[model samples]
Target: MLIVCHPVLYSAVVILRMVDRKLSEIAYSIRESFHDSGYTEIFPPAFLKSDKVDGFRFIYRNKIFVLEPDITLRLMNRHITENSKIYYISQQSDEYLNESLKAGSEIMGGDEDETNIEILRMAIKILDNLGIKNYNIDISLTGIFDSYVRKKDGQHLIRAVKSRNYPQIQDMEIDDKDKLLQIMDTRTRKSGIDKLDSIIERIDDPRIIIDLGTVRQPEYYNGLIFEIYGKQEFLGGGGNYIMKNLRGCGFSLDLQALSKLYHGSHERVEK
Candidate 1:
């Protein structure tokens, strides 16, 4: 069949391409902002040693297409300065696709990095022109492993389809230190309190405070951390991880989700 002569199919293809172009433009703008902010972009390998990916709160092995033993772009970075700001933008796997409506489709997806870093660099500039900004937003990440999971037929299953999968943490506006503490306790025990103190002792920085009250529920958050809540939920947050030979803090903005919650109805934004 001559592909170009089919009007209906051609129109569908045209619409999909147009939508993809618009989405790509938006993704590019997000990346460019990172460069303007003095971030030296690093390409980390997506694939890793099998053991490293294990016990992660996100994607698991059985769900992915395993073409190679090594993970793609397996990556990490170091700050040139004490607080050297670095920026990275690339397609990240939504490991929890198995739990969503799109589960039946081939779950493996990619984000834009282009075939070359030079192309990615140019794309970032285009995105900067498109008006993406520092947004205080509420966002939800899907397929996030909830600690309070269930075992049915000897296998763990997510408790609810979309129920609090990942806390719309960016949306939570926490004010009182005491209230944050209560939230921590309500979720889990004094898991961070003792270990946090030890991590503080090693640092001895007057600027850092080991507050049990400011905890975000992650099993690996074993040291210093921080976040800002803008009247509804955590806007942006990150913490230190020494065990992985990594030590850094980064902020994530959910502009699309923010637009939904405040300007309209909350929608899922890819992180």
Candidate 2:
């Protein structure tokens, strides 16, 4: 007897395999890049006993366990000395139980400007290594938004700005509403734009963008924040944060999204 296979199913399987292979290749490139930069790879446990963690929680043998949500937080929990450069390729689950594959590196303790430039360079190199040419890094300072986020109606204001709801933002009773609106609309500000300019000058990358309205994870990031984009599709983001009284800066790339983007671009090119 002979078996019959559907053409669509077979095609889907082949595409998935190609994506898997691409993902592996990208991950290897990321690890190699970090390794050459003198970053030591560290592995953190998947499950934590702390209920305070903002991650997927489950009951295991009548005990509560939380999946590792953020690799940086987990690493901060361990003893790390000043100037510790580390990297990890890990699976992280958020509060909604959505799992994502991430390749990231963290630099603990260094001159702010030097460390930031180093991280940015590494991120750019990873993209270059993967042959992702059409990409940009949107940079912002988290502190610039601190005042607005601390307001009583801060959350609503943030939502409005993120969505570019001009009327809604104007109606809100907030100081510097005009500035906020301008930044949201233009994605640039004169106040903190100089920091971004300095970084760009040092890196000399035309793909770096000064975006003042990037407000994601405002509470988590206390300093320079950046998001990587592959032709408008979000790859991942990172910034400076203080954890366990230690200052650290890092960035993570979404391996799955990257694989899709890379393969999709190549497929289109082939066509």
Output the number of the lDDT-best candidate. Answer: 2
The clash count of every prediction, one per candidate, is 22, 0
Regions more than 4 Å wrong, model 2: 1-8, 61-63, 163-173, 186-194, 264-271
Model 2 lDDT, full chain set? 0.81
Expressed as tens digits, the lDDT of each residue in 1-271 for candidate 1 is 6645589888999977755554454445555655564556654344443433422233365553311111111323222334344454333343442210000000011211111122223322322254333322111221222332223311112222222323442233323424433433332222354543443444333323333334333434433344433345333344433323433333333333322223211121423
How high is the CA lDDT of each candidate model? 0.34, 0.81
lDDT of 2 by residue, 122-192 (tens): 99998887778888888888766668878888888877766668788778899977777777655432344
